[model samples]
Target: MNKTVWIVLALVAVLVIGAFSGYNSLVNMDEAINGKWSQVENQLQRRADLIPNLNATVSGYAQHEQAAIKAVADARAKLAGSQGVAAKAEANNELGGALSRLLVIAENYPNLKADQNFRQLADELAGTENRIAVARKDYNDAVQIYNSKIRTFPSNIYAGMLGFGAKEYFKAAEGAQQVPQVKF
Candidate 1:
């Protein structure tokens, strides 16, 4: 074979290898984003699952706190039915607010606070909330990495060609950064 033919073949081989590598990288990043999102969803579901038990225990002691209980239920339903990451995050924020109200109601009832089951459930919910926070952070981190990859130069070219779009970060809903007003 001519030297020119050999050089051309080598160039083509290098390009093929580089293209394959880029495509694989995009695939891995996309999968990481997807997996992180699942973790966030699982943690949210765990928090939602604990709501019923928490509400049931609190209801027996604070019958007058019906509004808070209803709010939590409504928020949980909304979170469960939410479609995308943005919608789910908004719904989850609403649920967090409702849960805060429910906890406040419990504070008014000494008996409920002292109850063993209520304490355990509250502890579990708090732990679940922590998990949700960690999961959300991890998910946002993964999204950041994936989004950066899709937006950056060389990867951006491959990402666009491969249809690897940017992933959304889990952001706080509007007014979430403000200090919540607590009234007596």
Candidate 2:
């Protein structure tokens, strides 16, 4: 009888330990997802901040390109006010298209392209875009891992009990699969 009781106690202790370990792991993964998302937001904010200066430089040389300038401004505002991953992704695509048009208009003015300030701003914007791409990839990767964990055995049970839900991925906007046509 004593041996049976000892064996039962050992099993109970093991189960308790396993439960604590699983819960801690889920919390860690959830926090990791939040950190990765913050990085994506940081990169996005960097790009948003760069837009005004870029628009100013382009406008000085291409004064007649008011429509393109306004488009970029409007897209930037939309991105700023956007709340979720999907909304931001859409706004970002709009901003990207606007920026492309603005750049093309700048191409018509050799002076704008050659200006030191414009050149520097353009390079910085390019770098920020690259950063944003990397950040988004990182965030999506985290989301994938978290989602898989919450759908798998053992962890799934803990996740459901703890109210941990799946996170959304930062997906590319529509029409992004099409190749853009460039003209000289």
TM-score of every candidate = 0.93, 0.92
Clashes (N, CA, C under 3 Å) per candidate: 0, 0
Question: Which pairs clash (backbone N, Cα, C closer than 3 Å) in model 1?
Answer: none
Q: What is the lDDT of residue 139 in candidate 2?
A: 90
**Per-residue alpha-carbon lDDT of model 1 for 1-184, expressed as tens digits?**
9999999999999988988998898888888888988999999999899999999999999888889999999999999999998899899999999999899889999999999999999999999989988998998998888888778888888788788887778998789788989899
Q: Who wins the TM-score comparison?
A: 1
Report the Cα RMSD per candidate.
1.8, 1.8
lDDT, candidates in the order shown: 0.90, 0.91
Residue 11, candidate 2: how far off, in angstroms? 2.8
Candidate 2 residue-wise lDDT, 38-67, digit = tens: 898899899999999999998888888999
Question: In model 2, what lDDT does residue 118 have?
Answer: 95
What is the overall TM-score of model 1 with all chains considered together?
Answer: 0.93
